[model samples]
Target: MRKVVKYLIVLVVFFMIPICILAHPGRLDANGCHTCRTNCAQYGLQDGQYHCHNGNSSSSSNSSSSNNSYNNVTTRKTTTTRKTTTTTKKQVYGCMDSSAINYNVDATNKDGSCQYEKTETKTEDINYDTKIKGNLKEGNKTVIEEGQKGQKEVTIKSVVDEDGNEISSEVVSEKIIKDPVDEVVEYEEEMSDSEALTILIIYVLNIILVMFYSKKNKNSKLIINYVRRIKIRIIKYIIYIIYFVYVIPVFIDVILVIIDFVKRKLKK
Candidate 1:
């Protein structure tokens, strides 16, 4: 019984495992599919943050001749400034779940960290389990067998990670079967009609004798005789009933006898 409960637990774990994986908030999906997905204002895929700026620039010019042709004096001034900055970032996602449990270690990130979001969907198909209920004739195996004996057909599925740890499970279908029990039969030797009548008459006489003797005599010897007669009559009645009602029709006992007879003949 304890073992049966364990199998059910394993099966249930298989089915429910997918749900558990889906239920949790997935690993942070900061890394969007940026290749085709053009870079947004806040972030860019191909090129990271880029900035360029110029502070300010000014110029002035004036001139005066040595011969004093021009009365006013001239002056010149010039200024230049500039600013620039750049940044790059990458992400990866897909087969190898960074956050998921370890199962397969062979997967890799194709190009740098190509950030990806996990979108899981369930797949339905057959799974192998040896535990099944039924008459394990030779090769047959069973999962649960205590409540009743039978050939129970069951459909079970479980969800697990790459490794075979039980996560969640469900029953696709089930059938309860009852094993047929052979009735225990007692066989007695058949008797002739004369033998039957003889016992019947003896039973009646014993009853009468016991009652009448008890009424007349308080003697121990007579009581013992009455009991002995009753024992004999009971043994005969049992033989008649067992032979007619049980042993003959059941056939198992008769088969055993036939087999023994065949064995004897073969030896001869």
Candidate 2:
């Protein structure tokens, strides 16, 4: 039983080595293919020259003394030979990136050969100011001209090196696509006729109230009260005269102009 187990183990080991060699034939040598464990040149062809041999030996002999017969035969040997040659390759250099425009298909190393489109842009700003040309109230604004943005286009020219790096850039041509329109805001600082009239009325009423208070608060000092009353009356009278002469005339003129404009509009 021991001998039979040993024999079975030997058979299994013997068969397993050949099976492993057949399964991984290229794992033997890193630089080139290797022969199998059977020494029969494995199964497939190798890179360099390879040879395999299989031979069979057989012999037959017969002798008969009674008849004194003699026989002879000659055999010729046959052999087959196979040869292979491998050529050494050179290293190729070119763009290795697949997304580049100048990608080379037969490139073995990256040479950084690539190209791309270039562009540039420039811009400027426009400002505006407010102005008042006619009679109008203060702190008022109106848009006389609308505002718009402008842009300038430039054709950028650049030179790239053999390594796909930008060496220099220049503006070849430039032109304005749209001219900026400056904003114009019309402002009004002067009051109209109706506003001046209302202010004048308010001032008159305020002065009358002051006079009534002064008269009611006339104290034991009668002379001082009289002088104060005179000063107040004189100041108010002068202010009223100034308004009537300068401010009131302007108001009247504005009213006349507005009435004329309304009549013309009605006629139309």
Candidate 3:
């Protein structure tokens, strides 16, 4: 009976050996190979060792070719998946117009938040100032120096639309191109008619006194000669006044009339 029991145990051990070899927990790859997970030394393999089954030459070649094909397919699938993921990435949106102040070069789409800048130049006239020199007669004007206008250049910066229409503007810089020249005026002073008449009356009274003194001292020869010289001087002054005030104007008018008549006769 012991021999019979020993024989049954031997048979069970022999069948269990093939079962353990085929029942490795590691999964097979495309090459029909698997890494050893347990009982490696028993199978003549190390831990984490890759091994394949023994087969015919033709089958082994076919399996290797299939394994290479499977690897190529898997590589192609991984490349396509990466390409798809990149294509599906989130898009960035920003201003796309180059003229915009906040333009974004790396943006994928326009967000309609573009801001533009425009500059304009303008010229302005500066008014000249006037300076009065002296007290002049009423309604009389004499210009001593002519006045000139100045020019100013203004640079304006503005925010505008795409059509170049201005939305808002600000003065950026101002420069004076030319300075203004001030005007200078002078006036003349003159005497009144009433003062001239008083002077004439005083001169007449002085002449009468000189005449009375000459008659009172008829035997005084020196006094009479001095009075006669004074009278002659007064007459010469009156003649000079008449020549300047009345005679010169009338002479000028007569000469102008004669010249005009001569010109008309020549034309005829």
Looking at candidate 3, what is the lDDT of residue 66? 24
- Over 4 Å off in model 1, which ranges? 1-148, 175-268
Instruction: Report, for every candidate in turn, its global Cα lDDT versus the true structure.
Output: 0.42, 0.54, 0.64
Write down the RMSD of all candidates, one decimal each: 38.8, 22.8, 14.7
Instruction: State the lDDT of candidate 3 residue by residue for 51-114, as single tens digits.
Output: 5543312221122222321232111001123444445767999988887888998888988778
Name the weakest run of 10 consecutive residues (lDDT summed) in model 2: 63-72
Q: What is the C-alpha lDDT profile of model 2 across 1-268, one tens digit per residue?
A: 9999999999999989965654533233332323333332233322332222112221212211111110121112233687878888878998777765577889898766665545656654444334454566555588787777676776787766555578678988888877777766767564555766676566556556655664676462464545557757777576557534644555665566566545555868
Better of 2 and 3 by TM-score: 3
Candidate 2 off by > 4 Å = 1-74, 119-150, 155-165, 168-175, 180-268
Ranking by TM-score: 3, 2, 1
1 or 3: which has the higher lDDT?
A: 3
